[model samples]
Target: MQQKIAVLGPGSWGTALAKSLVENGHDVRLWSHKEEPVQEINNKHTNEAYLKGIELPKELKATSNMAEAVADVDAVLFVVPTKAIRSVAKQLVAVLETKPVIIHASKGFEQETHKRISEILEEEIPSEKRQNVVVLSGPSHAEELAVRDITTVTAACEDLEQAKYVQDLFMNDYFRIYTNTDVLGVETGAALKNIIALGSGAIHGLGFGDNAKAALMTRGLAEISRLGVAMGADPLTFIGLSGVGDLIVTCTSVHSRNWRAGDLLGKGHNLDEILENMGMIVEGVSTTKAAYELAQDLNVDMPITETIYNVIYKGQDVKEAVRQLMLREGRSE
Candidate 1:
């Protein structure tokens, strides 16, 4: 069934998803806060800053007005940064007249409260104006998916029916979606993997061999699983697409902002300088702080995350942090 969908973000991921939905025959209205991108998307059918060298579907519409985007839409996909969720949700509430399936694709937690993206959404959007909220996440990158790369992601919601509904809405020959009922597991995995990716890039920057990178990825999953389970996520979810799958891709791919930022850090650049150069949000930097605090509160043993936190926030040397990680007491695998 063809439906009207509003994609609430004009970043690479948001534009890629909107393009996919248009290809799937859905009427897509991509919302952007900036008028330049909105005009570029509607008039030129391109988001040059976010998705360069990629042509968007001409049928995809865009607007700066949130009311026009959410009005009469069957679903609204929130694709903004983690910090922006509350503000966007509050604006959404003012205009949303009827309930629509709320799907969020962004990953990360609220730095202040340490709440997941889904939790933030539920807290902001009233129950009467929203149906079940779903999370779409995995290893897929916007650059690859924009070019029609075969990608698989998980649609997670507590309600299986809602997950399946989202699965049907996004599934295509190039883009495949699976349904999972473990929303916490999926969301936790999605948020935490970025920290690991940061570590992975640091390993590469420090001139570490493949063995070191492999070790980082492996042990990173262990700590990620530990924190996830402590937060009520299923252990098995870590091995799924949103867990280890997302970790591997984000850590290894040059397209990942977190990995790229970490790479600059490893090459001896400061956080402020790296952020200035990257010109995008590297979620892991913020996520590292949130996960570090959460792990401490939960009494979870996340040495990797702790070390990364110190390196990023405490001004510790990256090489020194790696040495400390290696010198820690060994535990059984």
Candidate 2:
């Protein structure tokens, strides 16, 4: 069966997913707040600014009008940034006319509220307007997905059937989807891994070998699981795709903005300089603060997260911060 889907946000990930939907024979309309990319995607069948050199399918259309893009769609996907999600959800409910399956591919908690993405959706979108929100997340990167790389991800919702529905919508030969009922675990894992990715990139930038990164990632997963379990998430979900899988890919991939940002920081560049140069959102930078705060509130001992927070926010020297981390009291693994 064909579905009419509206993808809100024309960033690299959003554009890539929209392109995939087009190839899957769906009536896909991508909503972009900016008219420049809208015009470019509709006219040239390309989003050069985001997915450079990739030609989007002619069937994939884009619109600046949010209401028009989602007018009669079967599903509406929010692919915008974390900072913009609440605003976008507010805008969606204002124009949404039917009960559509609401989905979000964006990761990271709201820095102010420390709320997960679905929590924000639930707060903003009335239950009368939609079913439960679904989260699509994993190690998949937009750059690779745009070029049809083999990618796997998880679609999580409290309702198993809803997750299966999404799994069917996205699964293809090159793109695989798994369903999980652990929304809390999946969302937390997806957002928290970015912090570790930053740590791994800093390790790489400091000229450390693979052994150090492996240790950071391994310990980072332990920290993530600790906080996650404290917040009532399934312990086993930490080893699943949205958890360890996301951590591995983001920490090591060249396509990770968080890793790139951390690399620059490790090389002595400030956050302002790195952000200006990257021209993309490094989610981990903000997530580090949010996770750090959450950890403090939960009384969870996350040493690596604490160290990264001090280095990034307190302007502590990266090497000195690392030295302090190394000198901390050893604990049983």
TM-score per candidate: 0.99, 0.99
- Which residue pairs in candidate 1 have backbone atoms (N, alpha carbon, C) closer than 3 angstroms, thus clashing? none
- What's the CA RMSD for each of the models? 0.7, 0.7
Where does the lowest 10-residue lDDT sum fall in candidate 2?
262-271
Q: In candidate 1, which residue ranges exceed 4 Å CA deviation?
A: none
Q: Candidate 2: which stretches are off by over 4 Å?
A: none
lDDT of each residue in 162-241, candidate 2, tens digit only:
99988888888889999999999999999999999999989988888899899999999999999999999999999999
Tens-place lDDT per residue, model 1, 1-333, is: 998999999999999999999999999999988899999998888998999999999999999999999889999999999999999999999999879999999999999799999999999998889999999999999999999999999999999999999999999999999889999999999999999999989988988989998999999999999999999998999999999899989989999999888888898988898988887788999999999999989999999999999999899999999999999987799
